[model samples]
Target: MGKIKLTINNRVVEAEDGQTVLEVARENGIHIPTLCYLKDLTGTGACRVCQVEIEGARTLCAACVYPVREGLVVKTHSVRALEARKNVVELIVSNHSKDCLSCIRNTNCELQRLCQELGVREDAYAGNKTPSTFDEVSPGIVRDTSKCVLCGRCVAACKKIQGLGILGFMDRGFKTKVGPVYDRSFNDVNCMQCGQCINVCPVGALHEKEEIHDVINAINDPHKHVIVQT
Candidate 1:
């Protein structure tokens, strides 16, 4: 198409028309954090982590989905942007169980990592911490809706990349969740157990059911529960 001139983090850059602001920013080493943006996959913009303040826009736009336009001025990490991102992470954390130390992706989880980076000491919202059950029907993966941030990466991966539309975001608002139809188990659907959902999951919400934590605990337990998976 055509070339567009945009200012990213106050630096003028030339980007192709229709190119996502995230793409242009990354190309220029401007880190606009993203979770639901998997290259060559779907850009659902469900996660607001990549949000940037665009001049003349009424609200912050998702950089991964917002197209670059001529003479666009984008602020990647303004005070407003930081607060918005921090609030987004806090909202997700509010619903999630604060068992990060026991989680499989404890140290490696992207959501946890972002929380640390964003400096959110505790969730400020006094909302409901709705408890949900875990889904361990599959062998290689576990689904925990309580920890889901509604990033939609797993949904995109299953539907766009693997061509398996087994996962979807259900319900609305605070009750919204990602799962199969009728909130059924993934195994009940046509899932292939490819583990792409786990790969794309940013939090411990979706992960391989690993006994590594239990294994470590077993060293100190006189009667430890240790069941090896084959």
Candidate 2:
């Protein structure tokens, strides 16, 4: 594709014609917070955290999916854009599980970082939360719906990277969730246990089963032969 010039946050930058606004911004050292946008995965625009203002556009556009065009003008951090992004993060956090203190992905979670960055309040916009499910039936992986942001990253990773298509969005609207078909346990499906979903999950929604206690118990057993392998 031919290179095109676009203005992001009042800064003119040249980018490929088909590149998304988020790509151009990042190439120019501009920061645009995003969720549900993973490199090499198809953009779903499921999360509006990357929304940006476009000149002459009636509504804010998701930078991750909005392709850059010649003379396109974008604002990644305008007051309007920042407020929208902050509100989006707030909604996600309001319904999210409040177990970060003990959650596996606490400090390293993308959602947690976004909350801190956007200054989202712990109790703002609080309302009914989706009924949660904790599925530990899978020996190697755990699925916690309470912390899911519905970002679709794990769904994309499982389908694209693993080609298993074992995971997907189920139900509709407020009742929607991601899981194997018919809400079946991962252990009941043909999952490869490759952990690609875990790798891409933005929150504590998906993680490997915790076995630290089991390992410690084994170590304390006098008759147990535990050989640590790196």
Candidate 3:
């Protein structure tokens, strides 16, 4: 197979034919932010966070799914690309809960980090907020739907990586959410509680329910009997 030569941010690079722009850029140290993109899985291009400017192209292309071609010129940080990335982050923030200070992924959440990086000062868009019912029902995992961005990372992690098929999308546009089959609670499905879904979540939607603070205090009591390494 012939190598496809392309320019990313003014640097020339060669990639094996048929590789997506994102795969080629990643291999060459070009950092492109993504929300719903995952390896070895289907790329839906729904997030629009990985959008980049391709010379002579009428519309911005999603680097995750757009195939690279010979003589293509790509600009990852153009003004138009910046505005699109900022709007995507703002739209996600409008529907998300502003509980980052007390959330488990305060420092590590990808969405939060992107908001800071992109300087998303205001969520100009109106929110389509929906109330959550899983707060008291979820046993092993804490599911805060208010914080969900519908990125589908957890859905892919559950069905593809772990072959669990426990979580998925329910409802339709604007009201769509990643959840267990038939809109059932996580406990209703055959969840293994392996926490793989939680690890891949970019937001605070999925989290461990156990309180580490209480667990640590219980173990520190000298007079009380404590189970070690259980």
Best by lDDT: 2
In model 2, what is the error at residue 176, expressed in angstroms? 0.7
**Model 3's TM-score against the true structure:** 0.92
- lDDT (Cα) of model 2: 0.91
List the candidate numbers ranked by TM-score, top first: 2, 3, 1
Q: What value of lDDT does candidate 1 attain over all alpha carbons?
A: 0.84
lDDT tens digits, residue span 42-67, model 1: 67787788888999999999999999
Weakest 10 consecutive residues, lDDT, candidate 2? 115-124
lDDT per residue as tens, model 3, 120-169: 88867875676654543666788888888788888888888899888888
- State how far residue 84 of model 3 sits from its true place (Å): 0.9
Q: Estimate each model's TM-score.
A: 0.86, 0.97, 0.92
Candidate 3: C-alpha lDDT: 0.85
| Model 3 residue-pair collision total | 0
